[model samples]
Target: MSMDVRDLGGRPVIIGAGIAGLMTALQLAPEPVLLLSRSPLGADASSMWAQGGLAASLGDDDDPALHLSDTLAAGDGLCDAQAARRIVYAAPAAIEYLARFGVRFDRTPAGALRLGLEAAHTRRRIVHARGDGSGREVMRALIAAVGSTPTIAVIEGFEARRLAMEDGRIAGVLASGPTGPAFLATARVVLATGGIGGLFHDSTNPLGSCGQGLALAAHAGAVLADLEFIQFHPTALDGPGRPMPLISEAVRGEGAVIVDETGRRFLDGVRGAELAPRDIVARAVWKHLADGHRVFLNVRERPGPEFARQFPTIASACKKAGIDPVRDLMPIRPAQHYHMGGVAVDGSGRTSVTGLWACGEVASTGLHGANRLASNSLTEAVVCARWVAESIAGTPAHRTKPAIASDRPSPDPTTVRPLLSRALGVLRDGEALKAAARALLPPAERKDAASDPAAVGLMIAIAALRRRESRGAHYRTDFPHHAAVARRSEITLEAALAAARELAPVLEGVT
Candidate 1:
């Protein structure tokens, strides 16, 4: 029995009540909106966990051109120049819009906006809210603004299971409420569900960001891009913990270095070195350790007091791991921090499927391209969310349609948990990834290209395999030279599945 709705109260339904989702909801024109939070509004959302400031082009020294150049350079030739320029050009206005919602940005004594720097940034243009607690602070303001709005309704702890499409258009979602799974009213569904980090064995992304949205989008036949370009942050707390704690990039901006076991600066030859793009930094570190992560440093050099001031939270987290940032270098490496690839959405955040829009980390807006520059994800979130809202509000909702009834499965947390952990973590070669993907698929349609996780894995694995040379984060030890020519690797479900099957024989050996 398929259920559908045309009037879900008043406004569109937003999934994953994070900063992007909430901000997009607010930007709608008096639209009665439904925001579903899988956990308490702020707790599980990765938007709240971002430590560095929002990247922008506000300073006199910075301009949209500079920002675009940095973004494209970091993207490793996969970034869409127009999309990058559009987002960068919109930065100041987006930041101001947030300020209107009562985001109290840090101010200097002379009443100037305070800016900070992170890796790949040529100027000090990152606008932060609190000291190293920018995400938390910004999220607090947005959540509060949403709470006060009379038209917006937020339901917490309702984990969305799957999207419900009607006649090939998005109607609503099948979500798990407090009691049971049921069909919910979704006029137009927008997935602000964040990136795929918790899918890995080790990640800085909160446990909730397990690519549930990624899998759900793929399940719903959305096109995903650059799936293999996972960003591993340079300095994660390297002590005894299941998931590593992120040491903010601000520490490096304030003069931290990446050193090896002998305190030798191993990154001396690496371009941009410690300040290099994240993928380069991550691979350099991943080289030290074979299986999962890589190793490097967050050296507490000359500007100890300044580094402490900028990254107190990071300093405190390192202290929890029995390391002192002021005295010793924080032994660190890359853990899966951000996903550069996701369900492909255009500038307006619309997917190939109609009425389905995505923003934040969930949508590959082509703003991040192959690699995201430091602190830019947050900027992209605000800019893209506004664009999504503007496009969605003016468009008329489709005529009343019956809502699709959610297929509520009996609880099986353990099944999904393990399935994601082994197969989807950092570092996948052609063979093991294929096995992992194949093992993860449902038995009936393991070969089905459309929704098979194995097929998805094959797509990503083939991209990684074909690259042959190391450029940015997609490094292949087997083929470790940067090719003279560069091209973006995009695969249709069919093409990816064919490649996966062709390479299945080769990848089988790794597993």
Candidate 2:
């Protein structure tokens, strides 16, 4: 496929239209930027579906140190202390930054910010907008801000398929749009392309979020960290939906309970009960479901009649499922939500690859180490967007030769979903991970539509297989205890493919 080369004249190109991408473009403003979105703004983004809001130390009783403590605890001993502290400390300011962008967060009648709560949080630090429609409100403001900014050029309906690299550095971005493939030549590229939830069968993220950013970075030889840690929300509205509707943890914070179909409070004896860190709760819910018992979020007696008023988005979803949150027992199940892994980056969001930076769910910034604290993901995105923009602004845009490319179609995660759901779900074992790695090898080696998603799955399988002990979101059933010494795992595409190749013969012979 012949490509049209569009020289951006050293203008920075930001990929993905989620909060991170929009905010990064806004931050770089007065200076020109090219923002590429696969879909229109507010669509196909996990950030647009975020209901829990941004976690900030804005409560009178709260402090950034306290927020950092909760974050470190949730991370299960693998969080980078420095990075976590920096982001958490900047969170309150980040909230203000959003407000400046015209995000009208929920405020009290007396004109004070009304904070909410979520699981694993020690304080009421969740700064939300429109109650449960936080993401919608936030995106609305950012989209408006991007539109009005004279320097940021928004290009919708463009999917970034590959990073044009030369001599181990970024040359340009090859993207597919309505007309066809176009290569935007520039030295700087920022990947804010969201999570890998679409690679799983049951997820709360948009189905389009199949880790495209990770695939691009990996193929460009960037290192990825903690690929095994995928957080499953304990209460996705249990029913049929392409991407399951999330029953926000804020509902549980508002006094909801998890019980069996028989109305027995199954998590009664668990520490922190229904409000424990996500990994623990997801495991318990997954186990209960595996035991042939139906689980439901018993909000009938707790949030009661006030449920709809506080969580309109979730309420509407429940209503669509033919259940009224004020009266009915809402069926619930664990679904893949946040991923605590991606292109490994430093404090400035600069990846190992030169001229390449990553922010949001696509970058493993060492903030959410093993598992993410509820609502912290948004805070990280907002705070890191500024840092990423600054880093890009300071770096010189080197000119490169016109990039050559074989245009490829957007990735479809269908083939890898079941494989991941079975081998890398809430419960996993070495044998299953090995089998999955072996199965994904050939597809990952190919250059077809399945290759990108398959490569991502293969990497995750290899990472999970290597991490023998249970830790946070990644649990190996065969090795159900945490190791004495905690460590973060990293893998490159080549290393992951090599690991899979080594395991294929051994697993094939055993099978």
Best lDDT among the predictions, by candidate number: 2
* lDDT score, candidate 1, position 10: 36
In angstroms, the error of model 2 at 108 is 1.4
TM-score of 1: 0.89
lDDT on C-alpha atoms for all candidate structures = 0.72, 0.91
lDDT of 1 by residue, 321-366 (tens): 7777677777776677888887888889998878888989988888
Q: How big is the RMSD of model 2?
A: 2.4
Cα error, candidate 2, residue 456 (Å): 0.4
User: After superposing candidate 2, which stretches have Cα over 4 Å from the reference?
Assistant: 1-5, 506-511
After TM-score superposition, the amount by which residue 133's alpha carbon in candidate 2 deviates from its true location, in angstroms, is 0.4
